[model samples]
Target chain A: MDWVSHAQAELRGAGYRPGAAARLVLEHLDREDCCRGAQEIFDALSTGGTKVGLASVYRMLERLDERGLVQRIDLGDGIVRYEAARDAGHHHHLVCGACGKVEPFADRRLERAIEAVEERSGYSVVAHDVVLRGACANCRD
Target chain B: MDWVSHAQAELRGAGYRPGAAARLVLEHLDREDCCRGAQEIFDALSTGGTKVGLASVYRMLERLDERGLVQRIDLGDGIVRYEAARDAGHHHHLVCGACGKVEPFADRRLERAIEAVEERSGYSVVAHDVVLRGACANCRD
Candidate 1:
């Protein structure tokens, strides 16, 4: 099952009602490869004619985060961003410092290195985030 | 010369006066192997009988960051942390979720993978941060 369905099922099984706002947040996050901040999500949903409040978005994200249904990412800025959590197709972020653009990229070699670190350090790593910052191709020109 | 001396020289070259506060902040950060937040740095300095204000610490950190003298790190938490930037002895963080302990570990394999990504992605990756979260040995037991 996809992450949204799995998350819905998990929420329902945990006796929490999956309301429209919750579904909207999940669906919005599901469509994103890069993470979005709470305010950004709220603004997007509002622009899309949804009436979800910013507080509601934060609450829903907090709930999803508690259940490991979403990954919380900090782009070295003050804002906290959220993306759907997945076991496969894992990726990291490339942030352009000049234009504030974010892109997702995946690499198996990096994953192997992380595994090696876990084995060597004896820390049972449950989550990890990699953020690379620089001038993108567009900004570099 | 060490990172502190190099940073001090760079600041001087940039036409900025390296005040007593800046020197104290540099010395404190130089002694730490891990990153620390501005407030934490201020508190530590105050506890050690220094009278530098928190705003001065922030201003100093901003100046150093502009000169690439320090690295800014966000450990998936709300706080922004800083550490002295170095040419060698590069490392990433392994944070224990349960106890909130952050430990730095270095892996050349990871660096190679990042270099490979930069080559393939066409991004001029100038800086990067990796943060891994999990249970520490004591917390797991």
Candidate 2:
């Protein structure tokens, strides 16, 4: 099943009713390719003429987080962002410090290093995040 | 020079007067192997009988951050943490989801992967952070 459908099912199975607010939040997050702050999500939903409260969005995100359906990200700018959790096609973020843009990238060598760390450290690593901060080509000039 | 001294020199070169509070904060941060929040730094200073206020600690941290003498980290928790920036002996964090314990680990393979990404993406990658979340050995029972 698709991520949204899978998440909706998980939410329902976990006793969540998956209301209109939740559905909107899920669809919005699904459409995003990068992590987005709660305010960003609310603003997008508002701009799209969705009548969802910011608080409801946050609550839905919290629920999604608790159910492991969303991954919370902090890019060191004091803003909490969330993205849809996935079992495959995992990626990391490259944040432009100058323009505050986020792009997603994946590297297999990094994955191998993480596996090595897990084996050596004897920790059951369930999740990992790599954030690269730099000036993008556009900003470098 | 050590990281603390180098930081102090950088601060002065940047027209910042390294006061007693700044010195204390730098020393405290220099001694910690893991990132610490301002409140934690204040508490540590207070416990050590230092009279530095939390606000002073925060101000000092801000100055250090502005000078690029410290690295700010947000580990998907709401708290923002700071560590002394190092030019060498770089490392990342492994955080325990169960106990909230954070341990530092380094892998040269990860560094290689980062270099590869920077070259391929043409990003002037100034800094990066890797955070692994999992159950630590003690918590894995």
Candidate 3:
């Protein structure tokens, strides 16, 4: 079958009943290799003739997140963005406080610090989010 | 001459109009040294007989955040929590994925990593938020 069907089957194997919204959202995320807000996903689905409710999109996103099928990024701009999990490597975000742009970034030192925290705190770090807020280059110019 | 007044003065100095909601929100934040969600702030204000809408709390929090008078913490859940910026030293948060408990933490290594990111990215790096999510001790049991 297709990638979406395979994902749905995998989720089913993991005891998650993947619905149409989940399939649609996962397909959209797969097509666009970037983070997307719930409203953005809803709008894109609607525009693409797959009408889905914002609440359903949110619910599906949360389920997908719980199942490790998606990665949720919170940039602290009152918006939560999601991207499909492919290998689910750890990353962070650089947010432009002036223009509201989000850029994904990976830092070795930051990862090392997280490992240090995990070693000291006795808390297994399942996931982490780091967002640095500042003016982007364009905004600085 | 109190903390709220000082925050208002600072906001005014930064060309921000300190509204009644902002003042009240600042007062609540100052009184409580923990992160608070918008609804929690609104309920507290309501219980204290100082009527304020949830939207107003959110707006004031955003304004206070912009003025560096408040720190917004995103625990990767849907809600964004706010705390008054005292001395405004940088810190991070450890969040319980199961119980939604948030614990504030400071790490010199994490701070150094942020400084490294600022040096490398050339972004002013006005602020940074780090959320480490895992099961707390209680939840781990």
Candidate 4:
């Protein structure tokens, strides 16, 4: 996991100021290894001294997405969510609508089908996000 | 194709007034096949002197959706789109983003995967809609 220093460097490369807010988001969400919304990130970063607004969180996250440091997911909600792009492996998500629990999984077959569509359609497929949403284990019981 | 009278009967059965505006929208979108959005349906009825407000179009369409007379699709666009649901079997769409054209296809492999997930998780999968968007051949050329 990229710690605070490395995350700050990433922000600097992405042309954002190496501020405390940006570093806090990168490190915390990168460590979580799952998708999260901006409000959740703000909660994680809130401290007595550190000041971060939800709007700033959204702006910083959008900047990270532009820099390829993170990916934004729509998740059928009006608000967009983010997951870190560290290690750069392809994967998809399983979301629990009941509890909002998210599980990330790597599915090769689905990826191949997407690639096939790209090749056949002549659309240079930049990125694809596959999501499967349903009730999770505990939610069923 | 369900004409105005039958649609009026269906609506009346559900206690909806068979108002001219509602009937206009119903007739405009009630193709033997294909779905139609509120804007398209409104424009189609406008030429015929139907005094349908766009808000009424939206509300009537939402009511149709609730009554199983129509289906709404995301299309990845936040704008809610309505489609007539007569003979509306389960299917998915291949949308050409560049041309705004849509084609429908059915793949049992996809259905099986949904079934597999439902069976494995014991979650009663009600329904699903898959949309694949890309630039079409003309758009590429």
Candidate 5:
């Protein structure tokens, strides 16, 4: 099977209810690989012929996020966005101040350092997000 | 100088706008280290006897954040919250799913690793955030 089918199967294997609606979301985000808001996803979904409603789109994505199938990104913009989590490994966020594009990244060193900081400080490090906003290649060049 | 004064000095050194309301905010956040939403801030300001208005608080915090004087944290909630960001050098966030408590941490190694990932992936890594949801001390214990 191809990667998309594998992904869909994995998600279903994890107990996600199926519909052309949720599948369209997963496939679109899988191919796009960019942080997208609900509206953007809805727009893309409609263009792709699923004809899903916005409320269902939002709800499906929310479930996906809860299931660890997606990640929610906040770019300091008024809107919230989502991206498919590449894996269960450590991931980080980068946001383009110029165009509001978001990218995900990972680093083990930072994870160790964070553990050390949590140990040193009384505050237990539970979770964190680091958003750097600046011009991206598309905006800069 | 006292800790609060030291904070003011830091802001001044960084060229951020400084004033009584800002100072008050710094002190409040230092004591709590909790993300206070803008409305909570307005309420606190009203009770603090500085005759501070909500708009003034908003503007002051905006300026402070621009200078990296404080941290603006988005909890994926509709409202963005504020904290002092004291010695907050390169930290991550941990959020409680049940209680809504947030903790900050730093992990340099993770930061570097994320940088490398961005580089290899053709993404320009600027900044990132990692948020984990779980129970906190108060909630768990």
Candidate 6:
């Protein structure tokens, strides 16, 4: 919970204060190596005896996302998943529709293609999300 | 409403019976050129004096998505936007983070890359969604 003081500093630099709930969320994200949704984070906090509302978890996550402390991923299932952006860098996901398994992927060639797209589209691409949905190997088996 | 019989036929062929509520959702999608969420469709139905619950709209949309009768797009803001897939072959979007404006886009190179990713990952790649978010031209102005 203390190593995330940097994340709180980032929020503070952006003119926002990160409180206990924010710390719990960041602590959860820091420990978690995979992407998680707000509900999952809220449930984890509640199970740990932390008193926080689901709405507050959502609000903190949204603010963290806006500050780039967390990366929001859309798995195309009406749910936005979040992972800590710090040290996670930029990446995409191969999400299994059947199992809800998310496999993070990165490719230099795809990055170049996305840059070319930004040039052709005339829109400054600040952030992009690529989600490939299909049956995983186990699911297909 | 009757013109969407073909859509219902597609659903039926896929072993799904398009109920009255499903028909209303399909009719709404048929007329909408842009993507919409379940609540929007539900509100629209209510405004037009069509009685359909929000949960029913959500259920129908999920069923339609499972049957490949509709395409769901996630704009990364925790909202899953749906568009009728009968005539909407395949496309991506440049979503305005500021105004929620979705601009559809298509790219041959990106499509090829997706195909390549499918080959490499061994996933069937049933469907893929690419969303680029940034400030729109109007927002920048």
Off by over 4 Å in 2: none
The docking quality of candidate 4, as DockQ, is 0.27
Candidate 2 lDDT, B4-42, residue by residue in tens: 899999988989888899889999999998899999999
lDDT per residue as tens, model 1, B35-101: 9999999999999999998999999999998888888888877788999988786788999999999
Root-mean-square deviation (CA) per prediction = 1.6, 1.8, 3.1, 4.5, 4.9, 3.4
Residue range B1-141, candidate 5, lDDT tens digits: 544677678778877657877777667666765678878887876776656678767876786677666677777778888776566455667777767767765556666765665566444544445555556667765
Clashing pairs in 2: none
How does each model score on lDDT?
0.89, 0.88, 0.82, 0.67, 0.69, 0.82
Which sections of candidate 3 miss by over 4 Å? A1-6, A16-22, A49-56, B1-5, B15-24, B49-59
TM-scores of chain A across candidates: 0.91, 0.91, 0.87, 0.80, 0.71, 0.89
For candidate 2, lDDT tens digit of each residue in A1-141? Answer: 888899999988988898899899999999998899899999999999999999999898999988888988778887888999896857888899999988888888888988888889888998888899999989987
Clashes of each: 0, 0, 0, 0, 20, 0
Q: Candidate 5: misplaced stretches above 4 Å?
A: A1-17, A86-90, A99-101, A111-130, A134-141, B1-27, B47-51, B87-91, B106-130, B137-141
Error of 4 at A121 (Å): 2.9
Displacement of residue A55 (Cα, Å) in model 2 is: 2.4
| Best first by TM-score, ranked | 1, 2, 3, 6, 5, 4
**Residue B47 in model 2: shift from native, Å?**
2.6
Candidate 3, residue A30: lDDT? 84
Worst 10 residues of 6 chain B by lDDT: B1-10
Q: Over the stretch A1-141, how does candidate 6's per-residue lDDT look in tens digits?
A: 443787888888988877888888888888997889899989888999988889988998889888777888877666678998865367889988888788988776777888899888777678888888898888876
The local lDDT score (0 to 100) that residue A34 gets in candidate 1 is 79
Tell how far residue A29 is off in model 6, in angstroms: 2.0
Q: Which residue pairs in candidate 3 collide?
A: none
**Pairing residues by index, what is the TM-score of model 6?**
0.83
Model 2's CAPRI class is: high
